[model samples]
Target: MIFLIYGTDKDKSHEFLERLMARFLKGKNFFSLHRLDEESFSESVFNGLLKTDSLFLNKNLVVAKRLFQNFAAADYILSNLEILGSSGNVFVFWEEKIKDDFLKKIKKYAEVKKFDSAARPDFKKKKEDEELFKVADLVALRKKQEAWFLYQRIIMKGGPCEEVFWKILWQMKVLGLIKRGGGRKLHPFVLAKAKRAAGLFQEKELDGFLGELVQIYHDYRNGTADLAVGLERFILRV
Candidate 1:
């Protein structure tokens, strides 16, 4: 059997991986766990998959993260899916996203399951969910502080607005503070922070803050506007 778990949401992906490990490998301290790097991943996975179990166990489980860096590794794994089932060895592959071609090949011989982290519901309303969110948020904030300092340093050294915006976006993306797609909305804390920063703006101006930020992003991307100006406008009129 083969399982492919993937999603853009890291938290959910990690949670799913942990749950699967607990379910399958519980109380089995003899099971081997390997963390493979990009350079050695292909070799590690190949060897791990092909190894014979001596414990008389019915199944050998291999869990790999970010398995394939190139088509060759992916092709190798895809071709061996049938062998996995025949040998009673299960390969569990986890990643953020899989290419369509790779996914198709894997599905040919393996039972494929996808877990999307982004599809999860809002965590703020549930007690367990809220605690998880808070923990994640606190870690993110600490990381953001480091990036924020670096950004300020770069800006002081005459970095361009586009550069700053890119840095900011990267940080926000890491923090999961930015939403994607149409229905995606800003976090309450983010909105509150923005509103507080834009204390100079009137009540009427506040209504257009998000829309203007979107416009600013579009304009900046198209090279028609300066990111610094847009950011200043945003901070001044939030």
Candidate 2:
């Protein structure tokens, strides 16, 4: 059998792959596993295994992650979908994203599962959180008036200053990550935006802003700075 587990919710898709493996291995006397990732996957390895049966095991479980990113590997796999689906071995494939045209062809022979980022539990932001996110985004774009206006609107609506502070902190951290993190953990769109914002400021300038925000947080803790007001001032300066 062939299984395709993929989408922007990579973490969830990977978890699904793990669960399938676990269920397949449980109560089994003998089993074989072959795992492929972007860095190490080869068409030769896949072809060799595809043509053979497990020596002592009932079946071979092949797990491939982001293998389709390699055009050659993807082409080979796509070309052989028929036999791969009918083989005694099991193949579980994972990808961050895939094209619909190719997916339709795979569906004929594989069990397809998708995990959309919007459907992910962790990606479900509250309405307030979206407002805060917009505020943070405006800050990234260096639009003082828009950022300040939204910040005030949030406050008027009973949104907490602490939430504002934390969101800005997180955005700043994302900017920093763009500078040095490569940030594979972040969603691609978020990373791309941060990267676009990175060129707007010098590294030293970003570092200074982080230093100042931390000091503001400390001052808030010490009752010397009102967080809401301080963030407003900070917004103007950044």
Q: Would you list the C-alpha lDDT of every candidate in the order shown?
A: 0.53, 0.82
| Per-residue lDDT of candidate 2, residues 6-121 (tens digit) | 87764466558768888877885355777777677787888877876666646778888778888888888899999999898888888878888889999999999998755435
- lDDT string for model 1 (1-238, tens) is 6677776654455557667766666785455444442355665557655675566743466776676655666666766667765665556777778888887777776666565533434552254333333322332343445434444444464433453444334333433322222113656776554333333334344334445656888765333576666754443332
Supply candidate 1's per-residue lDDT for 11: 43
Off by over 4 Å in 2: 54-58, 119-238
- Highest lDDT against the true fold, candidate: 2
How far residue 166's Cα lies from its native spot in candidate 2, in Å, is: 17
- Worst ten in a row by lDDT for model 2: 116-125
Query: Which number leads on TM-score?
Result: 2
88 in model 2: Cα distance from truth in Å?
1.0
